[model samples]
Every structure is written in structure tokens, then in C-alpha cells.
Target: MPRRVGRVFRPGSLADVKGRPTRNTVAGALLLLLFGSACAAHKGPTSNPRAERELASDLTRVFGAPVMSQGLWGVEVKSLDSGRVLFEHNARTLVMPASNMKILTLATAAETLGWNFCFTTTLETGAAVEGGVLKGDLIVRGTGDPTINSRNERAAAVFDEWASALKAAGITRIDGAIVGDDNAFDDQGLGAGWSWDYLQYGYAAPVGALEVNENVARLTVRPGATEGDPAVLELAPGSGLQAVNHAYTGAAKSAVTIDFERRVDQPILIVTGSLAIDAQPATRDVAVVNPTIYFAQSLKDALIARGIDVTGGAVDADDRGDLPAPDARRVLAQSQSPALREIATVLMKVSQNLYAETLLKAAGAAQGGLGTTEGGRVATRALLSSWGIPQSTYVQYDGSGLSRYDYVTADLIVTILARMFGDPRHKDAFVATLPVAGKDGTIASRMKKTRAEGNAIAKTGSIANVRSLSGYVHTRDGETLAFSILANSFTIPAATVNWIADLAVETLANFTRR
Candidate 1:
């Protein structure tokens, strides 16, 4: 028989055909046992070990690429199912997060303040109201609610509501000027750490207790033809602000530099610019100096335009004792948002700086006296610490990540994401706020062809030289993954940074557990 290539075994017995012939059946069984052990050694780990290795290899290839040279970059990814780190690279390194800082602020708010939290704006009376007529001052108290003027139409609509309420109350005339009660919050309308240059722009407008139309005024410019002629500038409707037009006409080829400044005491509007008559209409939204007075004046104008008469102009706290109170108690109209969760979702998805700042102040006001950004920051930090997050990880100077000084690590963000996922009360709200890859928010243009496109929900951050992405991604194996990738001092352009973020997300989607 062709030298018996192998031994023939029957049940638990084996036959040895080699030089060492086995006279007993037990000897053959020993030979078979050795064969089985050798085969078992070849099979190790899990069913998908090879797949896991391939996925890891792909991630390393991208990270090690020459294009991504940087100051520091870190990535941390963990599986929600197994609670194991799937991939990690310097995950503990601290770096400037840019707009990604909003993630911390939003997460803190959602954790401390529930999803359904709503802000209240009350019309309180400093004096008594008798027979549908206030005997003293009318107080419109601001609890530091930031959603005061999210939209122009909404702001105008609110004024109409207040006007109707005043008319229905049968108070056609007022004995004193309307008083704006913004003392609910401190006088530090702007954050101490905010930069002066940012304050001059609309994005960095100061947060006030009595905010109207986002405490902004629109200046519409219509340039006059011919050289040396002045440009005509007009204010938007219901904008009780006055401007001194210092804009002059210049050569058609000359570019105009517009300058505007608002002082607190006198509140003078100074506009200086050189305009070419043929240029497109220029428009600028400048922050109002005193939001309380602006709102008071706007309300008075609206009421007067609606046929109601007022005896006095808008007044500050000093004239509160002399103003008449509301004659009737009617809600008139109430402006409510789509819930805190929805707001948070937008704020995180777009990295909305203003919304985050406003939410911070609102939280502080809810805790106690006047709402303030500093108070809000303190409260937010304390709340996070109580939730088991390390205080050192979050270096939040402002609600928005506009400040370059703000810093956060990928590891800290991952920790926060994990905690939020574990909490049943906050799980939905927190998850909903993250940007869906290739669909909406900042990630709308990212992760096009990977499993992460619709499955990965994260927040994006971008500045001059920094880029970051942090959130959750559900793997193909039904495992939820939490990850954060932060890159600083990136040598590539912003578009390239985004590409790297997209690539990392794609890699995570393809990751498989062994």
C-alpha cells in the first residue's frame, strides 16, 4: 500500500505506520493525540482577528502619511459594547480645540439642565396696578434669557404682541417713561476674558439682560454717484438709533474701509468710510450700546405706531420709581423654542458661539440672582466636576470656542461622551446634538463613502491652524464607538484637515472586532 502515507485511526484508536511501529493500540492513540495538539496551536484568538488587524493597518497608513505633519495629533476610539479601546494614538495630549470647545459647554448644559428647560421673561410690577392702570412703573424683567432676539421677524412680532397687550389693558397713556429691569443680571454685559477686537464685530456682541434683535442695529448704505459726494445711509425699521454719516465718495477703483463705534454713555453712532458709487450696497450690523434702552425705545415706538400714546420716553433704573405699571395681566404672546435639546443640537452642530454663551448665562440666572457669563461658566464647571469629569481637562474661557486660549483633549471629550451615553435622561438630547456625517451641520460635507456617513455623529472644530472632530460612531458589528480626534499646528490647509478627519471617520467605520 504506497508506504501508508498516514495512519488510519478507528474511533479512539490509531495505527502507527512509521519506523516506530506500535505493537499495542494505545501507542497509536498517543500518536493521534500529538497530531490534534499541533492543529489546535494554528487556531488562535477570535473569528475576526485578521479583519481587525487589517483595519488597524489602514488607520496607521493614513496617520503616518506625509501630508499630515503637525504640532500634535491624538485619537481615541472605544467600543461601547465591549468597553475596549479599539485604537489609540496620544489620546491624552492637550491642544487648542477651536469651535470644538462648544461641545463641552453644550454637554455640560445638557447634563446639568435637562432637555426641557425653558427660560422665562416676566413683566413684573414695581408698583401697584389699579383698575387696569398701573399707578407706578412698568418693569420688564430680564432673567438673562439669551433667546431674546434670534430672528428679526420674531423680534418685531414680539413688539406687536406687547403693543396689543398694552392697548387691551386700556392704558392709552403712561405717566412715566418705561423702565427696563435688567438688574436681574450684573452690569458686566460682556465677558471679562473676551477680546476687544471681537467686541467690535457682531459675532462678539456683548450679552445683556435686555437683549433685543440680538442687540444689533442694521445700517443700509446707498452710495451717491460721482467723486466727493457723500453716501446715503439709513437705519432699519424700528431701530431707534441715530448715526453720523462720515462716509465720503471716492474713485470707482478705491475699496472702502467701514468703521463704526458705539459708546456706552452717549451711545453715538460714528460711521466713516470711502465708497465707490458703483459698488454694491453695503450693510453692517452693529451692536447697540445699551440693549435695555434700545428695547424700551423699540417697544415705545411699536406701541405708538399702533395708535397707543405714551407720555414719557424709555427710562433706565434711575427712573423706575416714577413709571406706571401694566394695567392688565395678559400673556399677550409668548415666544418659545423647540426645547433645550433642539437648541443644543443646533449649537453643537454648527458650533454656534452666541447660543452657547447665552445658554451659559441662562444657566447661571436659573441657579440664583442675575444671569452672567462668568457665573454661568462657574456653574457649568462645578456641575461637570460633580458629574465625575476632571476639572483640569476643560479649560473653558468662553462658551464659544472662538478664544484661542481655550483647550481640551480628545480623551476628555471621549469621557464626557461616554458619561452622557450612560445617563438615560440625557442620552437622547446629547446624541441628537451631534452632527451627522454627510448630512447636516458642520459634518454635512464629510465622510462621503464610508460606514460613518450616516452612522457617525460628532462635532467639528476648525480655526486657523487647528482642527478637531469628536463624537460617537456605531460600528458594523452593532457596536457603538466613541472617539475624538484633535490636530493642532497642522501644516495642511483647512480643507486638508477636514479630509483627515473624514478619513479617520471612514477608518473607524470599517473597524471590526476580533
Candidate 2:
């Protein structure tokens, strides 16, 4: 008979080290206490009779922790290799998905729009260009491309390219206004159910058919030389916005407090607060009031800087009454964004809300008739229905989970994962977009030094009291598992809930059926 090698302790038991402890004995106990879960990660086959029983009990204990008892949880884990349910808890219940909603939006977009899809923005004009001069407006028509941004001077770089294209086409001067035609997408910039308070931040930047620098204006605030001195401020891609600074420099080592107020449909950005004289320079990116005019004004500046003279001012197509018919206009220059697969990678890895919203509208225009939020929802619903997912199981208000109205079930999330896993065309591309544990994207710093590190890939969601994790992981025995963990209405700190979810994923990553 084999001898018992190690002792086991029940919860809160110290019998294993009851006697006077030796130096090695105390060290070993400390190691065990610190890495108890890491040790259990090397356990036997997760599906074996004994292992499965322990996994169930372990997972139950984890979700049943005192802090989690008051919260609602919807969890589901399954083996993709054998199509077996590994574990589940309230899997069918609806819960806030937060950024997890991007999974569904991106998956639908990948299938409906195809991986090679790209957005095209064109510079068109209806009038004649004679003697190096255009007789009418230079219209910039946008097709919901979110790539034309001013981050790191990228907008100027892209605009320089456009200027070159224009000069190459024999367009040295424009006689009319620089107009932005953003009719491809509806005029509603903000998403449904988005908080009004979040409007002032860059993350909540408005969505539009014509996006410039992600529809945000970057501001650099420098402290004045002395206390009570006015703070210095500068805006990037400076156009269509007016900054009113009421901020001052504070005493050395003082707290830095900066606040801004820019109401919707307004161009005046009121800056108020104080920055410590010794504080490092501060930077803030605020949402622009109108993306169309922003793009138009930016293009106009780029054109003038490139020696292409424009006599008229910048304006939106809707604001102008006399616009040429679509058929009568001719394309002068155009810019095509990167492929959808690359765009999806950025969207999933960073959980970019603007990209999510734009992709939804783009899919709507591609499959349905119009490029609108509701159209995207209808298209997504149609796709989900084809996969046998009932509409009652999930409610999608916006492509990005920014909408407080969005809700989904753990079952729905896993079902989408399983479907994507089974599709040969999209399997590799879709999975490549998720954030790997301790590797990259939003979860880069999470699950480090654990079995899940470099082994699990998932999307994380967080908004107020809601936290979610859902994606794929390969077990120790090489069996692939898809899981979803949604926790909502938790009164505890978000880090506490995140710990619970990470522990659960780490458990799955260490699972084996050897």
C-alpha cells in the first residue's frame, strides 16, 4: 500500500502544524498558505470522478464566499472538446454584461461584414476644376470610418496624404466651403442610456460618420510660474472649439484639481480649477461638440497648410442648402481604413467603445439598409436568431456596453463563444482578438504568476457594480473550455469581485483530466 505523503487540513484547521514547529516546517506551512491554490493547480484530471467532485465543491466555495453572497452571479463553463458542461450557476439568469457586450457585437460584425470589410471616406466635388481651381465645395463624405484620428498627430499625417492626393489631381485652390457630408450615419452622436455626466470625458466621446482623433480634443495644461498665476492651456488640432480658462496655479505640493464644462452642441470649453506649481504638466482629452465640423475644419486647415488655398470657410453638409446630387459628384481623393480584423483586434483588446459603436453602425449599413444603432440591433438580433438564441435572453441597447440598459445571460455569452469556436472561417480571427491573461489588453496585469497566465484569453467588463469575464481557456490536459462569469449588484469593492472571478478562471486553467 502506498504511504500517505502529505497532510490535508479542513477550512481554518491548524492540526497539520499543531506541535512546536521546526524552521523548515514553519517555512513550508507559510509557502502552502501563500500558494495553496497554485499547489492545487497541479491536481489530477479535472473531469475524473474525484477531481470533478472537488472542482464542483471548490467552485461552490468560491462563489459562496461571504462577500459574494449578497451579489448576483451567472456563471457557466463547458468543455469544447466533448461538448460537456463542466460547471454552471444561475447560467440562464440575466446580468449586466458591461464591455462583454462587445463580444456579441464584434462576432456579429465579423460574420455579417466579413473580415476584409473596410470603411471608405471620400473627397468629392460636383463642380468643375479648371486652371488649378475648383468652382464649388470640396465635400468630404464619410462612411463611419473611426480611424481618421488626431492622436499623436496622426490626423495631420493623414490629412497631409489627402493634400498630396489633391495636388496630384490638379486641385491647387478651392473656391467654396470645405463641407463634411456625414449622412451615411444618423445625426445621433451619443448612445442610448449613456450617462450625461460622462459626456465631458474622452472615453465617452461622441460617435459620428466622420470621426477625427476619436472625436476628442486633447488639452495640455501647464502650471504657471507662481501661485495664483493663470494656468497655460493649449488645444490640439485647434478648430471648432474655444477654450475659456479660469484655472490658476496653486502652491507647491498642493493638490491638483482640474474641471471642465462643455455642454452638448456647444463649442465653448470652460476650464476651471488649480494645478500645483510643482505638479507635472497635465493632459486631458475632452469630447468634441460636433464631429462633422471638426473633420471639416481639420481638413480645411490641412489643405491651407499644404499650400492649397481655400477662399471659403469650413461647414457641414447639413448646414448648407445647396449640395450637389450624389450621382453628379466625382471622387477626387479617398481614404480606406484598415481591414475589419485589425479593427476588431483594437476594439476587443482595449474595449474601445467608439469603435464598437461605429462597427455596429457599419454592420447595419452593410447588412440592413441604414447605418443606425437600431439597425445594428436588428441585424444582431437576426443573426442571433439564426443561431437559435431567443431575444428574451438578452437585451442589447448599444454595441458598446456603455448603455446601462444592456443585459445578457451567461448562457448567451457561452453560446456565442461556442458558435464562434465552431466556425472554421472565423475561429482563428475571433479568438485572436481577446485579451490574454497576464499578457496584453485590459487584463494584462491580471492573473499574473498563476496557472491562467498566458493560458487563458477573455474579455473583461466593468461598470459601477457590474463585473464580467468571458472567453476561452485550455485545460492542463489540453481540453479547451469556454466560460462566462458575470457578477452584478455587489456592494463590495470591485477588486474583491475581480479576485473571485480571476480565481475561478485560474481554477479552470489548471483543470486537467489526466
Candidate 3:
């Protein structure tokens, strides 16, 4: 394997789950005025190293990789008040971004769809209720709501509510198949450049307009009663995926290894591994072969559990455009997703890849009359371009940064962050969606006792060899600084990369311009 370190450097720098840690407090502003007075009174022609070497030195201390190594680091920071670049390192060099790609996907969606937009899932029947019986197919239509399995796991209960709604409308039975409409999005379950190994996991689940349980099924495995026996396996929600378990019970002190896999678009899951006899039961979440069909079947079962008779098996519908238009179908029940602002809030606070991807496709479908990854990318670039962000600055292959082909620069990230902060309509709600340091989201447990605690708000990204953190940091000097630090192809562990990134952010939090 070839190893190379490509990073550009100049002087200057580098650089919440709706928890408004920065929103409720402005006393720091008053303190800033006083601090300004103090600086003016005693400070004289202060030539701070911040202009030349501080950022470079700080970053170098954290990353000790050699020039010929595989490590690539990029740092960019700017003053929110003035869009001046303070530090630049490989600022224009493109590199893979992990989940940091969500920043662009989300920021673009916020601009294209407005902050208040929401997704709708509706249930309708072609025939009217005729005394206890739905005369025709019970149709469920979705516009890519990713919350069905996440944030709230009561989506099936919501389906129960839909069944009850039908019962209240004098329908005792559904005479036809329960149809799932996922045509809002093109049937590209996985993103470009995603690994097959990851595709079988929940985080890389099927991305359809309609999804149930995040399009994943949970499998629980427990050791057998004695050594050398077959382990016990169970599946959740009664998904029809047949499991071929090759797992065996091993010695009590032996390591427990469980592997879950299935062929592309296949319904049979192969489990190969072993569990220690004395090992505790473990659960694994794996992606479903077909999300649209899984959703239809799930709703079918939920309705049946609620006493609604669904005579035929659940059928999945690929596109709503092929069916009768909304005005033409007789609507029976409807479910609306939480407001876009709330969804975005959870999306960032949780670093939700599914939500981000669905929102990307949804934006494309709404704007260009087609819901696909390509359309979403076009819509995102068009919206950001209209806002003065040139598409040439970054190469985006997927909404989520799981794609190794996706490349972006830290400088562009900081540039966008600064623009978002200056956006009068979106600054508050948009900033409220990021993870807060030592408070909420992914960074809740980090930087608790430091100056960055409750003050640093940022997005985190991770992959095997890459880790990234980008966002705003409220400085002790009362100025909000935007920063992006991206490290790719490192030989170090993810924790080490994250710790280095945290050190960088803490440095920014304590930065004082002389």
C-alpha cells in the first residue's frame, strides 16, 4: 500500500441536540465589552503568534505523522463577523469525509426545503367504507419519513392508530392487500462506495421512501446450555427472513463471535459463528433485504394485531406516480412527521445517517419531481450554489459520508458554517441542531470540565481511518469562531484522532486574538 501525507499550511489557524447552551446566555457579550476596554487600555501593538505560528504549532503537536505517511490533515477557521480565513492547511485539498458530509446534506436541505417543512404519510382506500368492510386496497403512502423506526419506535403503534381510525370510520375489515407506497424515492437501498460489510448493518440499512424500524431487523443470540451445542437465535417483529445459523457453543472462556449476512436482495440470512457457553445473550441489528416490503408486512401485522382483517398478504408499491393521484384516491387515514426543524434537530444531535439520506432524496423529489440520490445531489448543489456556495469546492457522492468517494475540504466546511451562522433566517434553528459539548448529542460525555464544556458545538465524523469534527465554538472572548478539522487515512485509532480533534477545538475555545 502506498502512503503519503498531503496537507497545505499557512498562518493563522486551523481550526446540540436543540439544547441551546449558547442561546440562553448572552452575559458573555457584556463581559466581552469589558474585556475590550481592558485590552484597549493596556494592550499596545500586540503581535500575537496567532497571526503566524500558533495554529500550526498546536496542530503539529497533535499530529506527529511524517510527510511520507498516509495521514492527511486539513484545518480551516474563520471569523464569523468577517469571512476572513485565519488558518489554512490543505484547505483546498479534497479528502474523504465520514459523517461530516451530513453538514452539507443538512445545510442544503434546510435552505432548499425551508426550516419548517415536514413529511407526510397517508393511508387511503380506493373504495369507500360500506358497513364494516373496506371495499378496496388499503394504501399507505410515504414521502421518505426516516422517523418510523428511530427517535420514536412506536411507528407500529401509529399504524395501530391508523387501524383504529379505520375502525372508527365504520370499517371492520380490510378486504384487500395492504399496499406500501415507497415510490417517492428511487430504489437505491445503499449509497455509492458503501462497503458490503457495512451494508448488512443497521446504520447502512435500506433507504426507501417508506421504512419500518429503520429498515433493520434485530437478531438476538444466546449461548446453548452446554459447550459444543448450537446457540439459540431469535428474530424481532417476526420478519420472514429465515436464519441459517452456523453458530455453535464454545468454551466458557473462549471469545464469542457472531456474523450475520445475506445475499443481495435475498430473503435468507446466514449466521456463522460461535458463542461461549457462559456468555450473556447478545443482539445484533442487520439490514432488511427489502424495506418497502418489510414496511408493508409490518403494517399488515400491526393492523391484524389490532383486529383489522387483512385478507391478502402485504404488497409493496414502488411508485405513487403510477397510481391514482392524491385527489383521485379516497383518503382514509393520515400521519404527519414532526416539523422539519425538530427532525433536523434530532438528525444532528444523533448524527442520523438515515434521516440525512432520506431528507436528501425527499428534497430532490419535492424540488425536481424526482426522488433519487442524483436528484438530491442536484437539488442540494443548486440550492447551495444559489446561496453563493460554488459546487466546485466539494465532491459529494452520497448524502452520508459513508462513501469513500465523497471528498471535501475543511476550508469549504468552515466557509459554509460561517455562511449558515450569518444566515438570519436559519442561524438559530440550524445551530440548535448540533451536538453540544459535555451536554448532549455525541459529544455529551467529552470536554466536560474544560472551557469547551457547554460552549463547543460541533458535528463529529468517523470511519476506519478517518475522523472529523466541524462546527462553531463560542470563545471566551465572546466571539463565535467557525472551524473544521479533517484527518484522513491515518494509522492511528479513531479515539486518538477524536482526541486530537478535541484538543484542536479546545484550543479554539481558549483562543484570544491580541
Over 245-276, each residue of candidate 2 has an lDDT whose tens digit, in order, gives: 99999999998898887756677788899999
Name the best candidate (by TM-score). 2
Sorted by lDDT (best first), the order is: 2, 3, 1
TM-scores for all candidates? 0.77, 0.88, 0.86
- By the lDDT metric, which is better: model 2 or model 3? 2
* Model 1 weakest lDDT span, ten residues long: 1-10
What CA RMSD would candidate 2 show? 9.4
Per-residue CA lDDT of candidate 3, range 365-429, in tens? 87767688888898878876776777777888788888888989897898778777777787777
For 261-378, candidate 1 gives per-residue lDDT tens digits of 6544554667788777777778898765566777677766766788766667776664455433444433333444446886786578767666777777777776787677777788
Deviation in Å, model 2, residue 8 alpha carbon: 23
Q: Who is ahead in lDDT, 1 or 2?
A: 2
The regions of model 2 sitting more than 4 angstroms off are 1-47, 150-157, 236-244, 264-268
Query: Which model, 1 or 3, shows the larger TM-score?
Result: 3
After TM-score superposition, the amount by which residue 348's alpha carbon in candidate 1 deviates from its true location, in angstroms, is 2.3
Order of candidates by TM-score, top first?
Answer: 2, 3, 1
Judged by whole-model lDDT over C-alpha atoms, candidate 3 comes out at: 0.75
How much does candidate 2 score in TM-score?
0.88
